[model samples]
Target: MTAPAPSEKALVPFVSVENMMRLVHHIGIERVLTELTDVIEADFRRWELFDKTPRVASHSREGVIELMPTSDGEIYSFKYVNGHPKNMAEGLQTVTAFGLLADVSTGYPVLLTEMTLLTALRTAATSAMAARHLAPKGATTMAMIGNGAQAEFQALAMKAVLGITHVRLFDIDPKATEKTRRNLEGSGLTVMACETSQAAIEGAQIITTCTADKQYATILTDNMVGAGVHINAIGGDCPGKTELHRDILSRAETFVEYPPQTRIEGEIQQMAPDYPVTELWQVVTGQAAGRRDEKQITLFDSVGFAIEDFSALRYVRDRVRGTAFFQSVDLIADPDDPRDLFGMLQRAKD
Candidate 1:
């Protein structure tokens, strides 16, 4: 006898924002970050095996909406994210997102989740992982240039992955820095609130910029960045939006997630179209050099990629096994007869 196909109710597991946060808390944020780092790094190590494509974007005067998709031959994942820098002024999140993971065998979704928080987690984790390879040895301090919603997450990720013991924060808005400082209180790190970006970078071996503006803006100048510092430019993640000065870009050995996407959306966009930049996955897999010398300046031009989101979804999928953090949703229709979908729908009217 032929076995029954999977039921619709058993197909897709949905993790709402509440449940996503619950799963995060259940696993503890730091542990989740660490595990996510591992999972993301694993994917990067096998980077050649997954499908890669630039995110599809629709631009508007206010912001842009994007869909990033990828497949690993066996599973597929996609994320829907929006970047509206002015949203905070209107009491909305600057970045909001959701994602789905599906099986390649049946093209059926296996998991769906709120990826706003997961994106923040994965971005930080990806940065910390890069720093682990590219930052100066014994790096103990990080200069956080934009202390917005992502600041605290970056701080914790750096602490967990790279052993950063202090974070010096400077934002254009002092209130944001203050908010980050308060949020990070008693997190086992000496948090310094600085008045200027120059002051924030002093003695810092790692510099992270996460500003949210859609124009070509220099949050850091060449003169401010000394040698042997790893700059994680998370903020310069869209066309016409950047955080580092062109002079700094000219000086640093820049690394990036996906060169094609970064060429349009990263600080590297400010450089020559043919500008040479190393892919971070090469360093992750030891195919390329990272931090070649103590005096060499290195930069991670991080424009979030689809594979990282895929890895995050994969992590959540694995973590929720045999757990109640996810609730199955009736997202698909399953009929007793494969060709009776219409009949099933008709029966539901009874």
Candidate 2:
């Protein structure tokens, strides 16, 4: 039932929504993204050290809920995230998440935190970080194909990580593009609202597609993509969902976070079972190549892997160490005697 006075080991540090925002403001959003990229990159560099598995999922007619778990030899982490493309229309976030980080040595949770905004941040950081390795040299402009909840975050992240100063935005809804434009005003980046995806990518060397839909929709066709440009496709994250046409995938050298998971949930789902794709970790660790030539096309088919979330938790653990942006909660059941479970329950009756 109830435990007596708890020790520090029984408490879990929690970062609430307000505290998460405060942390972002404290570190500055772009700066936080840059830092997160570093953290994620570090984890990727030692990719062989991680225990990797595909996220477990429970699907519903309305949406899908997933549990992404991973652990290194020293630390363990997992996240509970949901994807409901229709949530915004119901006055909710399209995606919401929370996660826990545990010490592998003791199997006790060390951190519990909100990851709804954090997911958006990590996804953007992951994309921009990949671009640093995959994008063509001297790339400065980006074409954002979907201007929704993730549009602005993707924009600023590319700026922070890649020094991209110009963003050309397009959306099926003009209002969404306007919202992104209004949000980015005076952010020291030139933001352009465009009427078409083709116009958006006119001079952009990096094209980012982040539309939220649960279907195999082609936001960018093969002809739309030119040589030497890096395409960051962030929206096609689940089964039956993809953004790039198959022709584009065939022509470009695709890099993914995890080949097994991406084959099921990323754009590669549309490709043949034997279709070749390199893991992004390989490219990052120099085990494989990134961009080979100025005329080579590079595509990062991102589907939000567990290792990235684990790394995000790692970053949070480091950032909130001495900061006031978290609260402590008694999460573990701490009894006077480890084996006296019934005794602990009986003592609460008094």
* lDDT, candidates in the order shown: 0.91, 0.93
Q: Evaluated with lDDT, which candidate comes out highest?
A: 2
The TM-score values for the models, in the order shown, are 0.97, 0.97
The lowest-lDDT stretch of 10 consecutive residues in candidate 2 is 1-10
Worst 10 residues of 1 by lDDT: 1-10
- What TM-score should be assigned to candidate 2? 0.97
Task: Please identify model 1 stretches exceeding 4 Å from their true place.
Answer: 1-10
> Per-residue error at 16 for model 1, in Å?
0.8
